[model samples]
Target chain A: MSAFDIYIKSINDVLEELKNSGRRINVFNVPSSCSELPRTIPVNIGGNANPGIILRQDTYVELGNPEAGSSAIMISTNETGLINDGRITLIGPDIPESADKSLPFGQVILIGGASLDDKEHETLQQPGFVGDKIEGYMIRSLPQNIWSRISKDGAAKGFNFECLGKALIYLYKSENPKIESMEIIFITSAKDDVKLLDNISEQVRKISKEITKENWKIKGYDIDCELDCSSCGDKSVCDDIRDVLKSRKKKGLVK
Target chain B: MINIYSQLMSAANKSLFGLTLGPQNESDGPFIMGNGDFFIEIPVAFGCSFSDLTLTGAMGTGLPNAAELIDKGTEVGVESRLCNAIKVATYYLEAGLLKTPDMIITTNSCCDAMDTLGNLLNGYKPWAHIPRFNMHAPHSYDDASYEYMGKQLRQAVKFMEDVTGRKMDMDRLREVCIESNKQCQLLLEFQELKKAKPCPAEPDLAREGAEFKNWSKDRISPQVTEWLEILVKETEKQVKEKKGIEGVDEKIRFLWQDLAGSWASGTVLARLQKELGAVCVMDYVSFGTWTPVDLSSEEAMFTSFGKRFLLEDPMNRQALHTTDLFCNDILQIVKDFSCDAVILPAHIAHRDTNSRIKVVRDMCHEKGIPCLVLGIDIWDKRYMTPDVAFDRMKTFFEISGLL
Candidate 1:
């Protein structure tokens, strides 16, 4: 078999093992034709991802070469309205019906950066959303408990960054994923100025390279978004990216 | 009708009394204040805007000063006392205790603390807080922004009168000013006593003078002034005689990372000087002493006495930015004083420590001087005791030796 086939088979075997052990995993690709649909995956689904396989029981698998658990993988997706709540959308592969009945079906809510305004946050608290939809991929091969243990333990060893990078590659290397361009959006309440947007684009591009190791490139810069200046109009000022607007505008980024 | 001041005073007084009385005492009348022969303690609820804006403004506008506190320095004193005083004054005024004056006069010595306070008070009392400004140092001072501060104070006073039913009584206020100035002069005399070359009085005494002299100015007496005079004279005489702990490597000057003292911490620094052979010659307070105070009129004793009121209360730009410009100034002072080492004994475990460390690191790097940084609450021993942290400090000095 070719290298791509081997990678796909390896992931499928892990899903099978997870089903035998009694847990669930779901995974899906954004359909080629439905690119415009923002992901509507419900958060706090108790499982990592949806539309994927179910693990028959709890299981743990070591990731990365050093035989350390800290090098495990973590996957995240963009969930609709969860941006405010800070819960990214994720889903696992298909699961057996018997395994789903035995184990609780839920998304694993992240501890940090979750916002109350997000749908996942509401679902996690209330366990209900009017029209919940699940999308994206998941891995049942790794147990639910392993996500944090791997991240924290790896962080202690300075391998956390490396592990996270590797996890993203491992999850998306297969399934023939198409390239999606990352767009940097600059929104400000100040007068509409293209130069301001350019400065924001530069900053976003700079930070994007630092965090994603250039794997995520800025596709383009776009204007037409205007965020209300919390501080400019006798309101309490917020200390965020918007704070840099006045400085950046003077540098000729905003016109 | 029982006003908010009465209600708040009762609640706050109960809380304070409960704290002071310990656990066993019965809760009594939480009277905010009582009438005295010459004065009255009218309790009032201070608006939250002062703390919210001033603290935030200091943190933001004062970022430039972070380079200073992390550097080495000699003399240091905490001025949260001044900040607290302003806070109390604001609370009292908001609660209708202190009547809004026709003129809100102040000197220029305070940092962002006063500016923010003046603005916040004016915002709260629009009509009563009108403008009648005073410049602490009309000329020969840096930070020209201070020139406009008097205008802000005047505005605050006018706005205050508009809010409260009190009219400005110029004659009565002039009398109050005279009394207050005399009291402040007496307090200054006591403070001067702490400046003996060898410091005849204990460091703790000097610290108490620093902390409470302005606070208890309203309760001044002949006895208090006399006692202060005697103390100052005695301290001077003792310093001439070299009565205090003397003699260390003259080069062994230490810059405090911040003022590491409660009432108790001052005593500890004094002990460190004696035991560790180091002198603390400059600090945030040294810069603070240069702040302009009220100079409204000669007989405006209230102007003199209330100078502390006009000065930044509880907090000052210098106090907040000890880690900012003061750290760098301190390092230069250390070099000028020919100091040996720098030590930062901040409560590093506290939530505010990361910012403190960042400032300190900037100073150390700028001067290329080694620093001994440790974390421990100077007042409380429960968090991380000084003893446990002292060895780490010693180890740093061991590595770097004397600067």
Candidate 2:
């Protein structure tokens, strides 16, 4: 197996191990498209010669909706499988045309295996390597939006959602055989539809960040502070936290 | 007065044109770009026009929609907490409002935000293909840092020459340094004169001194020198007459800490003088120490420039050193300017300086000086409105009994 495939397999192995530990696994999938792309894409966009997917290519691939402005890719997996949402919706402009306007595109993958203890949570969610497996598509990740581009020639050769989605499914299944079921939704439509997707994605992103933060705290890592310490009024609390963490280190509980 | 205003306008127009249109002229000399705080002597020595990307991006006039320009950065995922000054600069590049420079020279000592902005700008189009020289300003001033920064200055000079096909004239650099020293001396003298009981000069004069230090490259012009001389003479006359800023009673004299209060409008200053008995006699930008350069030695001139870059540049100083300077200045100026209390504007755009606000405040408290830290945005008025800031200032005065 390639390095990318190996990485995905490793993540699946962790999930499988967690599943064996009798923990409930839950996964939620949300799909949205290009209107949200511009908001996430770097403002300094210009001609990039790097090998990735450029959305704006000269081809005719039934890009479903010209007004599809918002897009998101949100994936969340936890110990409880009771919260699984298996809804799959694929609508909007075709792959080729959607690539032309530099529109937003989103894909969310949810995986749930078995519930593991606190120690296994970190291993349960390993960074995925599917981004590199897809040829000629460059993915720029934001909080709620995953903006990507298809190369000019890639679009001409008929790289559409079907191929992209199928590739993702194949990669996930092959890598994480423990993942019992998978759901995929691709939305390519206009204003209100995109907004709905954005709302879901924003919530999912926030939840995912919170989960990651909690995991880090459990693992004895410093929680990220968004505000600068100088201007913050709660410096006393922050200092207390630091002192506790420091004392923990002195006691040799944390590595 | 019209002649001076016309000259200033003419220079501004030339600068604006050079920033937007001049780059399109391929045959013209290569553009040497840096942040606003870069040493002006090196660019002058190489006979290259300096492009301060931050200044051009934030303050460039004739924008159809300033809010839209700033919003462009937000759309690109630049966090709102980052310095608005930097965000606007990034927006200028992203929107193509500011053209790319032929080469980029940046120092990493300003702040994390500026370093990130520099990296983004360097990778952006037009500038993406150009040669970039990155220098690190050490956190502490020492012999090793001096040698290192001085070497970087020399390397920067060489880089400019390589890119622009121009040769550096040591003599010209020496002349620029001498002129810069003269201007510094005049500024220092004016700052001392500000200590008079009834301050002769206003905040506008301090702003003029800041502009002259930031922009003027050649020798201190006769007009500028004469203007400072006139202010000094007039202030001396005021001292003789025992007057205080015309009709105002000068109830409380304030040393506005740092660049935060420097952005207040003339109307704002007027209101403070007319309404609240508070006068901002000194500010961070106007009160920077200008280390005189020894013109006789070329080595000394370059070393002085390096020292200035590492030690003197407000943005480049180490965090602790910066706080120390602020605290020390507050104590010194409280006595020198005979100030009642110090007002720290706590500008949001300046994260590096803002980070030291707590330490400075604590130090002030220990020293028995009332330091009011007002959270404000120095550049983008939209974030913190003038009325809101004015209200806060009034509250501070009331609490401190300055009213």
In angstroms, the error of model 1 at A194 is 51
**Where does model 2 exceed 4 Å of error?**
A1-255, B1-29, B60-65, B216-227, B261-263, B317-322
Best by lDDT: 2
lDDT of candidate 2 over B95-190, digit per residue (tens)? 777655678898775566677777777778666778898876676554457667787888888888887677888887877676666666566556
lDDT of 1 by residue, B1-403 (tens): 5532233324332432332222211222111110110111111111101112222221221223322321211012223322322333344334443323333433343343354355544555543435433333322111232334334434444544554445545454444444434544443333333333343344334333333223232123243344445545555555546554334433245556454433224344544556665556443332222112333552322232232233333234333322323343454445433346667665432323333454455446655877766665443443455555555555565677652
Instruction: Give me the candidate number with maximum DockQ.
Output: 2
Docking class of 1: incorrect
TM-score of chain A of each: 0.20, 0.52
Q: What is the lDDT of candidate 1?
A: 0.32
Each candidate's fnat, listed in order, reads 0.00, 0.02
